[model samples]
Target: MASRWMWASQTIILLGAVFVLAGCEEQTNSAQETESAAVVSTPSVLASAGPVKTAEPQTPSMEQLVERYKGLELIDAHNHDASDSRYQSQLGLWKQTGLGRTVLFGDVSEPSAVGTDAVAWEAYLKYPDRVIPYFSGFDLHDPGCLQVIRGNLEKGYFGLGEIAVASTNSPVVSKVAWKANDPMDGYLPQIYDLIAEYNAPILIHLDPVGGEPLAKLEQALEEHPDTIFIFGHINAYNSPQETERLMAKHPNLYGDFFAGFTLYNPDGGGKAEPFLPVLKKYADRFMLSTDSGYGITEVRAIEAMYRVLDQLGDPVVQKNIAHDNLMKLLQAQPATQTQLKELRKQGAGGAGTEAAPQKLSKLEAGRLLAQAPKG
Candidate 1:
């Protein structure tokens, strides 16, 4: 009996040992499987998903783009001189950017009298080479104004006013209070007469407040088919329709995009979209000017204009706005032939005749004259 009981106890102990060994092996295998799965899965996940991406670089702003073209030659079609100090400061800025020449329109608001012409002449004499003066008309209502216009023309003034004509009202009849009036009647004929006589262009400041000015413009176009006019301050056009209609109708009419930066958002908050097709359609007629009055320096104003052009897309358009169109207009002028000769002579030690001379084109002489300046 004792031997049988001992045998039973030994069997039970062996069974317990076997069970313990099996449990240990199962745990080892499970742990090994979990580690291997982690390694395999990690590599597959890493392979499928690459590293994170970073942002791209940025482009330069409009102002910076303009600064790049500093020291380039530019012609300002419209400018004014109110004071000597202001004039010098403006001219200095112009020199920095290679301002070739500026067309100065005298203060038209000068009370209509001999004093106005004298003041205009004095301003011209102050900066002869730097400025091409435009004589102001006497009151369109006064016959004597025509005589003053002719006298200034004889003196070599390029064209007519920074003329303030209200398209809404006739400044001629309503001389005292020329509020905006549509169907501009009183002054259109007289102005047209002077424009025709001189065969010179007139700069008109049309009212932007109402469509009245545009209506007056249309009437004027019908009356004077041959009249050449430049709409000063493109901001006055107000709406796209007026701009398109007038630009399409008048070959001789042009737009000056000066002060346009301000008028762009009269309400003070909106995008100033490019006059797109308007600029593209009449790129030839359109010209850029600072219209930077007495306060702003010429260089700063010119830089501002260039900044606007830089945002205009591509260098070609920028070059056209900066130089080409103005060059074309300058070349078209009858004075170019004589001007070139004088420039050549000035280049040489020879005296550049101050007065405007008659047409003299001797190719050989001109060529020699050109060389003398360089030598």
Candidate 2:
């Protein structure tokens, strides 16, 4: 009996030891499995995270950009026909580039004033809704040129210029430069007053040379508070600080940022970023233009203008710069019969009627005649 009891106790002890070992091994396996799961889950959690950051930002598609600007009418406030042959070609380009309207004018640098004037007029007449023609036939040096300007205004012409009032440095377009005769100069003051009476805007290209030219510009703006003076190209070379100062001081003063020249000029190309603050600050006082200078192709000019507009960022500011500000200037009623009659009585130099070019294609004559005042 003693021997049987001893054997049974030994067997029980052995069995208990084996069970304890198996439980320890199972616990160890469970811990290892848990740690392995945690390691795998770390990367899985990261993989579920949305969109990895890219080194460069994605550019919006042209369709997306067009959608952004859908409600706004894009106007090119500074455009020209330097050569008499450029009007039709310009219109076609303007259409392709999505220009709603253009502030059209002839080039004073071009030798044939009449041909330039006629071409611009023909363009305006052909596409009355699209072309806002400004008279640029007169020489800035000749005070007598105002007479022709006044006569044109009387004969249903819009306003004056792209007038190279003080372009000492421009090799391409500023062939004829006007000197600023002190703060208030010769015919300009009169021209300003005359245009103001007619509720017209005058686009002037006064290269902000030294202190003197800018001073003259400020003085002119100060002297005629009612007159709208659009300083072409934000004066190209003027610093943003100076541009802001000028804009802040004068309500009558406005600027057109010449995108093409700024982008393409190797010697003085400027970035849109620097001027963005001032542009946003004086949003209503600035506009976008394709001055079409420096041999920049039409496609290039249009793209540069849009690039500037895109950098502007704010849709409201873009709209204002693109078209609203210029449209406000253009909204003034056409010279009333009374205004035209008064101009005639003044007997401003050119003929009672602006003389159309003797050689006109049937299409050209029809367009001009269609726009003529109905007697």
Candidate 3:
């Protein structure tokens, strides 16, 4: 009985040992599974905490952007300010359109009412900073005209006007009664001298009558290498050969695109096709201007001009024409400094002066018509 009891006890002990080993194996397997799960979760946590990579934002189109210039410092190389009301309206337009600086040329075509230094001075007083008055020596035959030009230069007028030496048969010049022998003929040399002395630029009305404009321009350039001459209203309708010839020969010569739409249209009188190739070739020497009158709105004119250029496939070039080129030119001049001083003094007297006028009297209109050379 003692031997049988001992055997049962040993069997019971073996079973207990087996149960202990199974529990140990199960615990080991559970720990391994938990460790594996932790390892997998660690990668996901690292990924969530890491720095994110993102793409750069795209640039906006030129049309989408507003004029980004900070101040009202635009140089309108060509503009007219004849009457007080017209001047105010145009001034408001400039302010509204974000054009801060303007160069006002008195009505050149006026017959009996030539723009005198006093008239220009009054206009300058109207919008000191905004308007830079340009003196026109239309009566170059008048010795007083030289005195006026000199006086205005000392007082800080921007430059001279749409002056022209009439070609033999330019209808435009002839209609305006602008004789080739008038003051401009004798005045040309003197004006060139004054420009060199003041380091100023002059705007010349150059429309080839009998294909001699290139020769005339060449001669002018040779005589006054230092004088900067801007050719007003480049032949928008002329043959491409003419444009190429003029641009290639004269480095000192520059051109403004205004009233070219009429000439550029094959069907007659509307928007011109994009002259991008020509524009690109002479990008540095060319500027965009609106010879728009007080009657026409500047916004509409600017929009139309931009639309034609936009088709050219380069927004940068358009931007340069719209503002950059003018800005660069204005910045280069010291006259801006004198103008600013006068503007500040004027502004101190009151809230600020209003814009100058751009109305044309009947006499002025007749003069402009008369000045149109016969071609």
The candidate maximizing lDDT is 2
Which of candidates 2 and 3 is the stronger one according to TM-score?
A: 2
Worst 10 residues of 3 by lDDT: 1-10
TM-scores, all models, native as reference = 0.62, 0.71, 0.61
Please list the residue runs of candidate 1 whose C-alpha ends up more than 4 Å from where it truly belongs after superposition.
1-67, 70-72, 83-85, 112-129, 167-184, 259-272, 293-300, 314-316, 335-375
lDDT of 2: 0.60
Ordered list by lDDT, greatest first: 2, 1, 3
Q: Report the candidate with higher lDDT, 2 versus 3.
A: 2
lDDT of 2 by residue, 1-375 (tens): 010000011110101111111111222343234333433332211111111122135644333444456457678887765344565545444543467887777665333555666766766655666777776666545777678777776555566766656655555443443433333555788888888876777877665445677778788888899898888777466677888888899999888887766555443344667788999999998988766543444445565677678878898899898988887776653434533343345443134323432232222232344444444
Instruction: Name the runs in model 2 displaced over 4 angstroms.
Output: 1-57, 61-70, 109-111, 140-143, 172-183, 268-270, 338-375
Candidate 2 lDDT score at position 194? 84
RMSD of 3: 32.4
Better of 1 and 2 by lDDT: 2
